[model samples]
Target: MNPPIDDRKEYSNNFLSTNSPIYERFSQHTPRCHRGFDLRVWLNNEKNLTRTTCFCPPSFYGDMCQYQNQRISLTIQFRVLSDSWSTLFAIIVSLIDHSKQRIIHSYEQFTYL
Candidate 1:
């Protein structure tokens, strides 16, 4: 059962929730994502004719989310001396292949204080 709608939340990522708020948007016949959520709608009035769109996680992509992007996400945390709490950090994160050339598939840069 779903929680009462009158309840408000400070923040909600319904897509990531077990008792998702978005469930109210789908029909009883709608299918689960199998690690990805499937957004489906009937094409025309045919019960057998339906279109599906997958809302995949960062590690995946594709029509039904059946394929992997061959990349892993990473998270990092750091602590500095109390005096340096406000110091800025210049960080670069990358995904590199293990082959001889060490190919860089993608990267991200972060500059924050």
Candidate 2:
């Protein structure tokens, strides 16, 4: 069987025309929406302006996404022995239920070297 030819393509801005909007970059800096995206602003032509809506994440809610939802944060730290300096470790941390059977509610794993 004959071998197929392989063609490799390099990325470039040559595909865009000289008059494209990619050249004339706008400098309008919009305010951030805390955790989410696009705080939309509406401005009537000859009337009033400054109407906006902040699209916030599920963890936050407010007119300007200024409120934060309640959450629990946990931090874990580990130390390695001098004898096993080059050893790689897979660490699993779990949350268990209080019962006769050790029911695991949640778990997270971390790789250490």
Best by TM-score: 1
lDDT of 1 by residue, 18-101 (tens): 555565555355455655887777887755788877799877777767778674557888878988888989999888888999
Pairs of colliding residues, candidate 1: 33-36
lDDT value, residue 44 of candidate 2:
75
TM per prediction: 0.39, 0.32
lDDT of 2 at 102: 89
What lDDT would each prediction earn against the true structure? Answer: 0.73, 0.70
Root-mean-square deviation of every model: 16.4, 19.1
lDDT of 1 at 93: 88
- lDDT value, residue 100 of candidate 1: 98
- Which portions of model 2 show Cα errors greater than 4 Å? 1-11, 16-31, 46-50, 71-113
Model 2 RMSD to the real structure? 19.1
